[model samples]
Target chain A: MSGKLLQVVREDGQVEKALEPRLSDAQLKELYKHMLQVRLVDERGMLLQRQGRLGFYISAEGQEAVHVGAGYALEPEDWYYPHYRDPGVGMMRGVTIQEMFHQLYGNRADATHGKQMPNHYSWKDRNVVSVSSPLSTQIPQAVGTAYAMKYRGQRHVAMASFGDGSTSEGDFHVGLNFAAVWKLPCIFLCNNNQWAISVPLSKQTASESIAIKALAYGMEGVRVDGNDVLAVYRASKEAVDRARRGEGPTLIEAVTYRMSSHSSSDDATRYTPKEELEAWKRKDPILRFERYLRNKGVWDQAWADQLREQTNAQVAQAIQLAESQPKPKLGSIVDDVFAERTPQLEEQLADLQRTHPEVE
Target chain B: MSRELTVVQAVTDALRTEMRGDDSIILLGEDVGLNGGVFRATDGLQKEFGEARVIDTPLAEAGIIGTAIGMSLYGLKAVPEIQFLDFIYPAFDQIVNELAKFRYRSGGQYAPNVTIRAPYGGGIKGGHYHSQSTEAYFAHTAGLKVVVPSNPYDTKGLLIASIRDPDPVMFLEPKRIYRAMKGEVPEEAYTVPIGKAAVAKEGDDVTVVAYGSMLHVALQAAMKAEEQGVSAEVLDLRTLVPLDEDTFLQSVKKTGRLVVVHEAQRTAGFGAELVALAAEKAIEHIEAPMLRVTGLDTPFPYALENQYLPDVPRVLDAIQRTVSY
Candidate 1:
């Protein structure tokens, strides 16, 4: 399985020259910085949750390359229907750290007005649709956006990211089948983290690989080294190009591992073996990218250390700013249910206001 | 110019009218394009609008709805047909969780302007699977406007209105009367607002409230009660979510009695909400206990569907019971 995967940057700080993406040194550093920022956010988010400052937190710790690389392949005009673990996609699309913290705090400045849980990012201006809790629901939606683009004769593509667990959902099959038949401009990226909470890939599917499922739908499928940022980006860039060229959809299976617990609510030690976690940590995405950068003669220990300090300070400042904001107004609870509040919502709002006069 | 049309014909007319006016409107469903829909409600649409606009989708309800939500978010007004209301269960999660909550969940950033059309109710002997009026399921979910039309005129009007609505709407067509019911529908397009109720017949005794196929049943019951010297006011609650509570509540207040009817099961049906509304708002004006004429608390039967659905006699009986109480 490892031999069949696409690899540009090896774990030992070497790259297959032919497979390496032609990114400039500045672009490469930005990618590394974004991955580092994602790691820092996860670390601080977990600590905030543990310290009882945040209600809940979900992290994309070890799999930063999968999200950042795939998301970087998408243009700003394209739409992204992200899985819960793909906050890096939002960050790459210009969702500020402060905005993420506001969402985590469910403050008045939050885009969703605290309607959704923490880590469920939604930025309409950035063409990033809201993230839902249910798995694989965004697959068909991504295809649909592609359908709209194709119908309007536009070249924009829509990409949906999910985990290995989502491959079993009905929407996954339906979305792939529809996209294949219609030749819709869409991309389905399966972040095969090998674990869906407590359920392992063995129980999730008997298929040889998640990408191979694309063959049954008459579409292209590719397997990539998830920890290798260059490989993920190359694969995703090819798929995005094919979609933009109206060549239909492609399914990219990025093999990775969830090094952290499923979320703040779970303990991976209860099910995940310690040796397995240790093995995955050795192939950590950030470390491998660092090695690749160092081998390219564009990285140093002082730069890396300073980057960490700046990211941590930025995360701390965002937490403070987000925490100082007040919760959403009580009257806003009934708002946004529709374009305009109906009589029922108005009556309910009045009743709530009457009952809690002190809040207003 | 007004032409006499059946409910199904009016559905085709409404789709054609809307799609012709708005190029951004896309119709996707199983058999909607080449087959012109299983019921032919989309007859001749694909030929006229081309396959790009009238798409014949794969037989996946969730895919149809989920994709439609995506299309709506991307600036297209998507109208997806479920083929049958019973078959919509596969897409229930999409409807309830995704389509219904996109606006509120996104803090008004994304409003999925989609109209999901499904033929519902139990009078055509399609049995349990083909004939189940589950509008209550959608009406119970907030951020969704549920509309059911009883006649050809209202069908075209309400369907047009639902498509143009800013939020998602569940437009449940009464298949029982899709062809059985007919009326003079206007040639030009018109919109019968989503949250308003129509008084089919006015009277002074008891208010018989219904929508879709049951509206005709209530009308028949009212006519029968008229001969029996018991006046019954028939109210057509076309939209269940943004319920025209004012019309029904005012009628209940004036008539001093109420009788609700529907083809769905008795438990947790839309009738229960109507009964509760009347009891809570018009209890002081009521002269008799309100009653509901609804299907039994059981699955719509294959052998005894007539017994399962609330008919004219059943509605008249409930009207009589409420009036005499």
Candidate 2:
């Protein structure tokens, strides 16, 4: 593990010329647009939750670069096991705003069919595993998938994302140890947002850094400035390339902050210091990426304004479409419990349908 | 051809046969590779299939099951052994919440084709942590098929069926009878349909319902009851989740008396579900109150294991009581 944090763009958006990735102007603009879309959608989701139109909301307000940059570095063949705060990753991988909205509303059109809570998106066709609530559980699952890939002689890699708090879980240790021992093609990304429902990173770990913890597992560890999109993409691309070359797993710790409250139910004001929040807001991922794009002559005020309007309009249309959809049908309640419904479940469903004829 | 084999040997035969047929089948556990498992249920499998398909994983139950779920999601048949049913708690959340709910929670997008095999029940004098019948935990959770085989024939057939099932199945082997009981088993690959029960013995006075090692005790008790001039019918419930209610209900209807037996705790054991099923569906045909013969409501003890588990004498007593009632 290199003790230094990898940074391609400084806080003022000035690039470290030697480390800056050689991305085309169009790709640069695309990255900024992807991050901006996440911000706009998250804002609308929060407002909807506050207005009682949605049940709950969790925003990745300050960690856009971490998810989007890393997601952009992967190929479509790679499998992603995402945490809840990964809407930006899904967007980079072809998840439409309408699809996300449908999930948030838990409408019949939702891919998960109202089974999981809002923001828990899953696109099986895109090779994205469903988001589970339990912490660090996906770590071992990702390793297992990577193991299968290696056994089948497939070149594809498996990547799993989680927060700093998840690093403390037993699954985290078990997963890393197994991957290291087997030299599986996997990537462990820690989105160090620094807060897990009001618990700070200090309370979560006493180590020098989350990346350095990988040394114990005998895997390569890289720490990057997660607020810098260029830095995150570079680190993720290198790790993805290494994994594809059969060099085994890599642990990438993208350090950033969570600018929003934990969820719709949380009040960040109760624990977060006012000054600390202000400091992180100035170094916001979107603002930093906008400066970087402007420095490259790819971003202008008019384009930024137009993009915001277009994105917000898209979000509005998606929200309308999702809200107009009906809730999942009553019979669907027992539909996917197994490949085929058991006789007992069939009897229970019959009883329910018989009693609630009006609902059907 | 048919040959005499123990329950444990039948398990090995089933895994070896399945692995030979399907290259995608992966066998993984703590001591599965090179060690052939602590109980030798996977004996000679790693040598035949090689280490890539037969893996020895780290000593973490959650890791074993979680990884197996991942493998299944990626279109592989993953059979993970928990070593013992007592040590499955660490992976309980993964099994109950993740593996069981993957198909439903994904809205049918992803269904984990995983079959978790574990050795359960008492009588090995393993005591406490090594001996427990925790099938009720998995049986209570939907999306999982809980299967327990009492004999060699059922062990091989049911295991093959569980591996081929589209959904996750919990295959709990009774360690007590893993080697103690032997029966003729077909060497060819065959599947005994899941969600079905077998009538081990048929009689008229009372119906005795049991599974796993307890089924052996129930059969013995039925024999003793027959000698005592009391007719006892034994029903071996192979699968508890998708329980064969029709078979048991028919037996209760004919006998007019129900006695459920299990080696799990007395409170809320699978026997309770059987009793409730009889009461709800066959209440009119039942002549007396349904009785449950199960382990006492306490942690499995080290010194008093014989007293802790349901035995032939205890089952015979329950049958006599239910018959006379």
Candidate 3:
């Protein structure tokens, strides 16, 4: 096969060999269900942030299939560096919804304390490097991990996910070029949702595709229909296997759309039109996957009803856990600053204490 | 015996020693591999260690530092390079946010054992971007151990120590002094413990403190002031964060006068912080107002960077002001 850019597991529930990974009926049902669950989570998170019940957050509602499918394909040992917009990606990698809620609530039990605004989540032991606020910043980091994997003689694959907008950053080019030259075991996945902040994909780059940029860096570039969960998963899995085999890095552009604003801070209505939104709503990844499932006999109303209840209950339980978690302490800002506090930090810590002793 | 090598050669030696000592220690940055680094800091490191270890990464500052986080998290010692300390603005998020916060965020479950090396200070003809001493910015951040070495010996020692440190360190090497300076770094390997102050010279008069390239100027200023019978004690603060505040306080108690010096523009440089600290803790020990001799508050001039930097004459002039006060 040239490469498995899996788009549909089957046509009319019949096996489609060349188009996508020939998934067993069970896996197909799982992908569709996960995409729905994640999409709901993404929408609810955005709504909660807007209602002032939660802090600022980036929603991945429309990009669920891009990450869920790709994320589900990963091994637990593989490393991930998800961006702020990739809350769903982390979720698929087994980061609990409870931890995600604590992240938004800025609770003491939160992985990153309250230092980062809502959406920054990571666990080092999980091999998920903490995400940075800057765009394309994690690309080189994934490359670094891949280099280490090669050095240590491990088959570990290092993957990073970002949006199309990140490609404009110098870090993206530099990271790809370096990985390509070194043959590092990494898969650079770009969920090209078409807009970075407000800049559309057409304005972001003149390249034929973000993945094609990989060609210049001496890596394979595969463009896939990102809204199709199977396509994203198959492309990512193939790239991942190549990385594990020590062939080199691969750049995958999962062409998709963002159904919502960039974040709670943004207003998509300013740039995106209602008509376009309506058009995209019809092509929703969740809906498409659902239709696919129905054709495969896995979409009975009873199964859909039970899954919805289970997912909503799980999401609610996570939110309740996050709410019950204690708020992070003010002293946390001063701690972990360094192994030893610098004189300057000591002064600041002192100043904070003197002014806000009750915070303790 | 004192010998000579450029500041560049001194850094090379430091990296070479650290790399040889720890297999986990790896180098990454733009042009650091076959290009031997833009300044040749890793001139032959790639060939010596193989590309796997001495990585020449893409020209992505954020990526460079971010990758270091991954490398360190995975149990490797990472020394990510910024071609110049000034170019670090692009990676500010990584340095200030992630590299500094990892351990704290993880509640000590993780320590970002990484060193970010960059050439800093002024007087080189490379104009503003290449010559600015941007150490104070890192000094202001909480999680990073910021250090500036003035001599080859200290450079070798501190770089070794920083590489071994189980935290993120911003190792600011004064670019102007690279190769322009030389010292007999002990042939054998050893490390300088962080959070210690070096008393460059002993005196009872006002104590003058400096770091990085400014240490050279401060020492010269003290020498020139001696002609006027003013015995200025010079202290070099190799590490900015995890400061030797006790040593600084002790110096203030004895000298009864304090003057902190640095090449970063004055508003919020380490000098300002040092003066404030002295005021808070050792106000009674000061016979005169704690003074700060710093770079002018302006964009570091491209042509007359020599004029902008705190030079021997400028240091001596500040000493005159403090002594007269």
Candidate 4:
């Protein structure tokens, strides 16, 4: 299984000449910086949760390459339906570290008005639809968006990202089938992180690979090494191009591993083997990308250290800012239920205000 | 000018009218395009508007609904019909979680302009799978408005209104009377306001509340009660979510008695909500204990379908019970 994995950088820092020049030095550095920045934010989030500062956190630890690479490849007009683990994808699409922390803190400045759980973010301006907690539900939504795009004669595509566990959901099959049948300009990206919170891929399906499931829907399927940023970027870019060209959808399964617990609530050590974790640690996406950059002679120890210091400092400031924001108004809880607040909800809100006069 | 049309014809007329008026309005569902929908409610739409606007989708309710929500988010007004309301369970999660919560969850960032139409109710003997009166399931959802039009004239108006509404709506069509009954519908586009109940027949003694196909049953029951010297006021509740509490409450206050009727189960049905409303708000005005004529608390029976659904006699009996109490 490991032999089939694609690689742009070998363990000893050797690169493939053909793909090495595809990313300019500046672009490569930006990709590396984003991956490092998200990883740092994820670490700080976990630390904050441990200190009882934030309610919850879901880390994208070793899976940063998959989101960052694909996020950078997507056009600005493209729509993204992300899962909870893809905060880096949102960050790449212009969601600031401060906004991300604001949501995590469930503050008044958050877009959802402190309604949603941490890590479930949405941005209308960036075309990033909000992520629902249920798995694979967003797949059909992406299909619908792409269908509308094709109907409107637009060249933009919609990409829906999910975990390997989402394959078990019926929406995954239905969405892919509909997309294929209609030739929708959509891409289904399966982040095969092996563990769906304790359920392994072996139990998830009898099939060998999640990518191969696309064959049943009469679509192209590609399996990429999730840890290899260049491979993920190249595969996603091709699929995105094909979709925008009205060539229909493609399924890309990036096989990676979840190097952290499912969320702040879980203890992965109870279910995961220590040996497996140690092996995946050696193949960390950040280290592998740094090795490639070092081999390109565009990176140095001082630059990497400075990048870490800057991202950590930014994360600390964001945490402070999020904590200092005013509490969300109590009336906001009943607002946004509809375009205009119905009299029914207004009555309920009035009742709540009457009961809890101290808060207002 | 008005012409005679059946409920199905009114639905088609409304879709055609809305499609002609708004370019962004689209129709997507199973059998909606070439087949003209399972009940022909969308007949000739694909030919009139082309396949791009009227789409025949795969037989996946969840996908149809989820995609419709997405389309609405992207500025398309969608009317996706579930072939039958009985088979809406598979899409329940999408309707309740995604479509209903889009606006609230997004904090007004997204308001899905979608109208989900489904033919429902019993009387034609389609049995459990084809015949169901389950509007209560959707009416329970907060952000989703539920509409049921009893006649062809109201059907066109309500469908047009739901499509134009910025919020998502669950429009339940009465399958039993889809082609059975006919009424004069106006050619010009008109929207009957949602959250407003119609006074089908005004009387003094009792208020009989009903909607969809059961509105006819309530009328028949009211006529029979009139023959028996009990004048029953019949109320047609067009929308269940934004319920016309004022009309029903005023009628209950005027008549001093209430009888609710529906073709759904007895417990936790929309009828139960009406009874609770009268008890809570208009209790002092009520002279007798309120009663309801509803389907049996069981799966829509295949062999005894008539016995399962609330009928004219049952509604009359509920009125008699309330009048004599």
Each candidate's DockQ: 0.87, 0.85, 0.51, 0.80
Off by over 4 Å in 1: A1-3
Candidate 4 deviant stretches above 4 angstroms = A1-3
What are the runs in model 2 whose C-alpha is more than 4 Å off? none
Ranking by lDDT: 2, 1, 4, 3
Would you list the C-alpha lDDT of every candidate in the order shown? 0.92, 0.92, 0.80, 0.89
Chain B TM-score of all predictions, in order? 0.99, 0.99, 0.96, 0.98
Deviation from native of the Cα of residue B312 in model 2, angstroms: 1.6
lDDT of 2 by residue, B93-169 (tens): 88998999899988999999999999998999998999988888898898999999999999999999999999899
TM-score of each: 0.99, 0.99, 0.91, 0.98
lDDT (0-100) at residue B219 of candidate 3?
A: 91
Q: Which of the predicted structures, 2 or 4, would earn the higher TM-score when compared with the native? A: 2
Model 1: per-residue lDDT, tens digit, A1-360? 222899999998799999889999889998998899999999999999999998899999899999899988989999999989988878887789999999999999898998889998899999999989999999999999999999999999999999999999999999999999999899999999999999999999988888888889989999999999999999999999998898999999999999989999999999999999999999999999998888999887898899899888888899899999898989899999999999999999999999998875
- Badly placed stretches (over 4 Å) of model 3 are A1-6, A9-15, A340-347, B1-10, B30-47, B57-63, B86-90, B104-111, B124-130, B179-184, B298-306
Docking class of 1: high
Please give the C-alpha DockQ score of model 1.
0.87
lDDT for each residue of candidate 4 in B1-325, tens digit (9 for 90 to 100): 8899999999999999888988999899999999998789999999999998998999999999988987888899989999999888888888999998878877778788999999998887788788888888898998899999999999999999999999899999998889988899999899999889999999999999999998998999899999999999999999998888889899999999988889999889998999898888988998988888889889888889988888877888888888888
User: Candidate 4's error at A258, in angstroms?
Assistant: 0.6
